[model samples]
Target: MGLGTGQGLHYETAERLSAALASRTICSVELVESLLGRARTIDGKLRAFIALDGADALRQAVESDRRRERGAALGPLDGVAVSIKDNMSVRRWPMSCGSRMLDGYVSPYDCHVVERLRAAGAIIFGRTNMDEFAMGSSTENSAFFGTANPWDLGRVPGGSSGGSACAVAAGLAPLALGTDTGGSVRQPAAFCAAVGLKPTYGRVSRYGVTAFASSLDQVGPMGRSVWDVAALLGAIAGLDRRDSTSSPLAVPDYTVALGRERRWKIAVPREVFSDGLDGDVRDGLRRAVDFFAGAGCEILDVSMPAMDISIGAYYITATAEAFSNLSRFDGIRYGHRSKVAGTVGEVYAKSRGEGFGAEVKRRIMLGAFVLSGGYHEAYYGRAQRARVHISNGFGEIFRNCDFIATPTAPTVPFPVGAKTQDPLAMYLSDIYTVSVNLVGLPAISVCCGFSPQGLPMGLQLIAKPFHEEELLAAAAFFERNHDFCRRHPKIDQ
Candidate 1:
């Protein structure tokens, strides 16, 4: 790939590109236009973005260049191109969330993350596709179109942040933001060979993001390298008065983790190695552990018995929250209304039935069931208690070990339709990941190895709550020594 050309610069990380832009080696307009042009040429096959406004992006690029010319550049990220997930509100953009429900609904206000990115002069250029309502493990759940894995187009990219992962993997954009309710960001990043982070639940504000599971959802960054991901995270992370769930904790300079190395007490849970894990993924995790051991870290074996029941608990609690959160999208005020409705009840039923895709509908129905009078105590309440058990279990583990390590997913990217027919199998894809969300801890997925089939595999490192600096530093340590992070998907060929 050539550096000056759009396609060449496509693989450049946000950190490197920002340095180039700051030094005037290349103008922001040129970089933005270059990426936009690359998107125009290759996004057809990848379908990573649902909406792109070249005119607006170019205008912002010009403004960024002018600010830099006047020595008023906001920060290192000023003028760096970034993509936002469709679920996040970006003023005047179509916030479809990969569903027909809100097809033409334009956001009137920017989300907190969007506000931060814009404030730092980062060019918010496109809306990336996602699973409908961020409910699926694969992009195939998208109502519009499924994003293909850049490594092998016929296979799937894990979701609901699949589009963002694909965009970064295919060199369409250097950085993108995705929500991680239950491994949505990390799982897809693993499949796409990119870096994805899921911060502690209240670490990032959720003021304008479309709620999936309000208690669990967190907006995080994705990029080709840990440094790039950390940079993006630093730019968008801080306490926000707009979101009540946002923590009032101070934000740290994430980039300070760069070049820093330390030996960590990393725990390996046996529960993560269930029969469902593919052989290649198991090998990948093993190799990653060996790498860390070689770097002077102690590898400890621990058992998280709560993991066995986490999937059931997660689905129960998450679906219950989803049922409550999605109740606002009835056709009466906003979103798509069904013309076939003849009564108020019909309006609610038909509009939702028509608007939501199968996966979303399934989740909504399951959520409603779980929250129903008789089942609420039996399922939802039980799940909440199970979540407490999982959280406590992690608390005890963290006291002894600095972090927990596991394979990001049970397997690498599978064929597009491989598990869609079996919902239970699809749910298993996130078995190793959902518990972190349950406990509201910070975690990251970094490419560790590849499957025999050539698909990317990731090793996840999870830290204690509000310990993102340590998490990113550990990831950067591995990234600096490992060769996996340097290999880009050969999609152009």
Candidate 2:
């Protein structure tokens, strides 16, 4: 039996585990059994998952075995179990987005990605925890649950995709799915020491993922390796008719097209590498570029004049959209209703006040204020113009570079609650990642180094919209040729 057919199936990437199945070293039944066991036992400390569907997982695993025996067409990820963020809807499964407002809501149909994963023979083991309505930078805003960092239970995993990141990093699953709005996926991936991808907006369908910001949300994979992310991306991505926003381009064969799939020109914006980046993070970035350069790739220094405004502009646009998107959650419709309220308005006010956590309410109020008549021009409108400035700046840079690379974060994950009281401080943590969302580009964060505190730091890769293949190729080259991803905190370390 392979190592994966064991009592604990954590820390292995989906690609690695799937390869074991193809070789017939382990059966799908054994793998899912062990993986599912972890969800029942190990998940209690991590709080990564909100619900588990053991019967469904077993059903899928058995079906995969029957298919293999019959020599039927098996997808690349046949029978691998993965957790979906609570915000993503899967048929008959709870899709609460980590709030009391949706305590018992179940999706009537699968989201585009869910259908693809099921078609590919993957099993949905459970729904993972997340920020309420995908609204905050930490899982602390989840009204029903909190996801702790797998590395240290006291620290956060990051959010609103923290649940997915924790599941992947903690070995609750080989891979998981998450949505990135602002830096939701990347930030949490960095904090949890996992690999996370944010597809170019429209690269993946948003037809069923609970909407926080219509224009910025994208569904991407969370895993332990570059290829795991790429393979999952290959299965779930491409155009979708259900979502008018999905891109019309053909999905590239990312796994086959990786690693210098033709000579490449990678870029590093010197400004992004400037001061305030921790020493270890700076060194990691330097080493990542040098490794690629040595492998016959061009590493160029590029600049964008408006990157300075990306974080601020992103807040304006995302918050405004969030305000509008969240209004649909009134108690009368789909969410939790206030028990003590008599009038409908009181029901709404009481439900909203009690159902939402501090961060969700803060953003909703801030968003409402910005979109209000008097504040629109100075706040919302100015942010939109700044977005144009940032977008044009990225367009100009892409003219000279095939892709951009930077440390996924400016620093390692700080202690949980380190910035909870200060929203501005927390927002600043996304300085490097929010710009990618603003430009509607595909980007990824892979574990690149451990901080002095022994937590992880992620190195980020950015590619043009619909160019995810190029981004992961660079990441694969980096992963295979270096010791960057070989270290993680261990009990004996």
Candidate 3:
């Protein structure tokens, strides 16, 4: 159980692991082996990883260690094992996005984030599971298998980044990368007691990443602590010409913002605290508010009426984009093709029909309907207009407050089958998170407190676009005063 031991190395924060690697207290190979062994021992129950190439990972680790011995270390993240969500491409690795549609599809090149991680000397650990096409709020929609919450095995890990969140929470990886279009990173981090960051849209490039909702999707980082998330973010966030939507802003040293003292103005949206919120979650939010207040931070009540329609607007907009982006997967290219098909049209029809899971098909159909004649203006157009209004609302709020605070999710992690049959309830899981994505702002979820049922809850802090440094600082302040991140789930191996 000692910090110097191999068993303890797997659960250590990336920050500490980096230090260990730098000092040669332990080599990168030892760290990778420990994590691989841990995953081999417990991943059957959690189902966090879709695929793990231990040989490739070790090869990368050995290179990292050699770089350090030769005094050519890449950076602080060098030698760290970072898990990747299945949606992001890694050269020669399967990028299925937890869908049968992309079954056996391997990428020839690394995604933007993966490229950055390699430059920083981080090892690509494995591909974690997720909701098929990143369409579901819970990972139960994954075509392969559902990931379980590490806190309570019976409960579900929030998704479609559940596998990434579960891997970090269960001590399988020190840090992980996840794609958060609508709370994929934060909600699961909340449900699993970890830290997740959804950076400002365009802050990180989206090229080579499988698109779910093109306009909304952003590469995010998940880890056991705010510092860990900050370190990962520092590495992967920057301008990329490959993605037209990528911002040209310079990436800041995110770790520098941590541990800095600041009295920030935090806005609490009154609309987010509704009757739908679980009492335990509400209580946790209240405690978080009190903590900030006690820390001399100014807390104000703000109203965002657009939040009321964020879910609807998000679904319309995201689904429409998903439909357009997914059209390329018609089985003619490199994805899953139907073995039994007569005509080319039948190939397209049967391929999609057989390849896509229920949730993905539902979203695609919904997207098609909204984009269809006579309905585009009625649904998709209005959603676009609503998106503007929502962005304006956040702009107004930011005019007075530095950040917005809310519960990451209305409830703790639900049982695996609890809301699977009720899609509406499942969709509501991202209620507090979608608005940030809609506005293309930066937001983070840190473990605020635990529910009465012993489940973790998150306090989501959102900031203006490209203000990740400030947002991370505020979350780091809270994390420093709380012990939530230090606690780990006891998963029996």
Candidate 4:
């Protein structure tokens, strides 16, 4: 139960591990063993990973060590153990996306991000659990199992990247990759009190990530510190021929932005903060604003009226896309097929019904309704127009400000199953974050403060498209003044 051999390495940030590996002071094999050992002991109750290929991870570690000894190490991530969300494919690993549909399916190829990590010599540690097909806000929708918050085991880790956040927060790994489709990465990061960055849509390639709202889905990085997050982002971000949406712009050296000071024009979206925000989160936002103002940054009140329609617009658009993307899972191509079905039609219908969880089914039905012939223009078309208005509003605001600041979520980590029976309540958890995805802007969540009950709250900073450097720099400035990221949750005590 104790950290065992991996005690010293458990809380080390990805940046620290990379340095240790590069200097030969610590080998990748040792670090991988320590982490794998810890995961074996702690992950049982946390339910963070759906798959942990320790043997393969150690083999990768040994290879990294050998390369380091030969002075041929790939890069900064050479020896770091990186946890991957179950939705991102890692060759030969199970990529269930916490769904029964792809339950036993092994990926034949690595995702674009995974390919980058492998090339960087990172030890592809494990596949973390997620909401089924990334449909739910809380991990309770995971068809297999739910991941618990490390700070409070009885509470839910926000999702659909709950397991990825829990892995980093619980010290199973110092770095992780999560997909953000309407706050999946940032919300969980906020709940777990970690740093998470969702890059500008198309900034990072999304070739092999299992589709979920294709237009909004993006691979992101999560870590214990701003530097670690920036580093991970740098490693995996670049142009990929396979992903048509990937930007051709050069990937900046994100680490250079760390520890730098610059006077920033920060916009506070008044509409977002006016109501429905929890007192603790509001307090955290106030403190964050005060800190930035004290640091000589200018804070201006701004308006994004269309943002008021973000939640409704996002669900409509995302669900419609999900419905289209998920149709391929119907027994014919790959994934779970119902044996009870005697005919092709029955196979398609029964397999999907049996394979999908409640949340997934609900979204699919809603999506079908919205995309139906008569309602398509009324619902889907309206949502698309709303998305354009929201994007334009963000565009106008960003032209004046360096970044936009707001609370990451309306509330802190909630008790597991508390909102499971009520989907609307669960959806509201991402009220503040959905807009960024809808607009294709870059955003990050950093721990701003904690509630009286000790749950963490996050301050979100959003930047213009392809401006992750500016976003990460601003987050690092705040991280420099706070120790929230340095402190690990005292779970199992």
Clashing pairs in 3: none
Q: What is the clash count for each candidate, in the order shown? A: 0, 1, 0, 0
Better by lDDT, candidate 4 or 1: 1
RMSD of each: 1.3, 2.0, 1.2, 2.0
Candidate 4 to truth, TM: 0.98
Model 1 lDDT per residue over 230-297, tens place: 99989888889888888888988899967777889999999888898899999999999999999899
**Inter-residue clash pairs, candidate 2:** 408-460
CA lDDT of each candidate?
0.91, 0.82, 0.91, 0.90
* Candidate with more favorable, higher lDDT: 3 or 4: 3
Q: Assess every candidate by TM-score.
A: 0.98, 0.95, 0.98, 0.98
RMSD of model 1 against the true structure: 1.3
Off by over 4 Å in 2: 5-8, 261-263, 491-493
> What are the runs in model 1 whose C-alpha is more than 4 Å off?
1-7
Query: What is the C-alpha lDDT profile of model 2 across 211-278, one tens digit per residue?
Result: 88887889989888888888899889978999999888988777887755545788899888667687
Worst 10 residues of 2 by lDDT: 484-493
